[model samples]
Target: MPTALNRRSLSSLAVTAAAAALLAGGATAANAVPAAGGATAQHRACHVHALSDGRGAEVCRTWTPHGDGTYYGTWQVDRADANVIAQGRFDGKVRNLGVQGSYSRVKDFVTRACDSSGKRCSSWA
Candidate 1:
């Protein structure tokens, strides 16, 4: 009861529907990656410094990953001249590692250890 032209239009419609379904399925597959809980680990670091004259101080700062989604941060100034601007996230327990005016000496040279309980960057910095 349908004309040849009607059959052609119906065929075209079917093809378009199938193409759309395939595209939708493809999109779903592409989004499944992030949902698998296989997320990647992220990291961050910082530097705190304040230099003046031939006497100032600075320290490269970084946080340790605790595996359970936690972090511990520490800062260190090389010389007594490594001027200080920020104390980093050292919880004040690590002798002379922190942010403050300007460094004048290697006063409390950091031992580069982790204060398991101390933290600054949890998910990031």
Candidate 2:
């Protein structure tokens, strides 16, 4: 039997490994396809990350296909004091969602954006 901590470590490792594989696959697909003249497709993946201990904000956005091409997205923000919550969707499209919260809760911040193209993008500050 493994301890709780050990199990957690293993779980994290698994997640990391899976993410890496997805990213690698995405890169291969991107290279195979041509994006110069909209040849590949309009579908895209966008990752966003934002963090600020003082006064700042983060934003992430991606262009979905003209209609039902595929939409996958993620957004994250962190401030002096805030709680961090991450979300992901396999099939869903919600746009222009506004954000509001107190900035006296979190210490760090992170934002990740992923789409149907298997492209994962993120930013941190």
> Which prediction has the highest lDDT against the true structure?
1
What's the CA error at residue 115 for candidate 1, in Å? Answer: 25
Question: Model 1: residues >4 Å from true position, as ranges?
Answer: 1-48, 51-55, 65-69, 82-95, 98-125
How many residue pairs collide in each prediction? 14, 7
Candidate 1 global CA lDDT score: 0.29
lDDT of each: 0.29, 0.28
Task: Give the Cα RMSD of candidate 1.
Answer: 22.9
Q: What is the TM-score of each candidate against the true structure?
A: 0.28, 0.20
Cα lDDT tens digits for candidate 2, 4-116:
11111222333444456567774332223233445333222223333332222333322222223332232323221233332322223222223422121222222333232
Candidate 2 is scored at a TM of 0.20
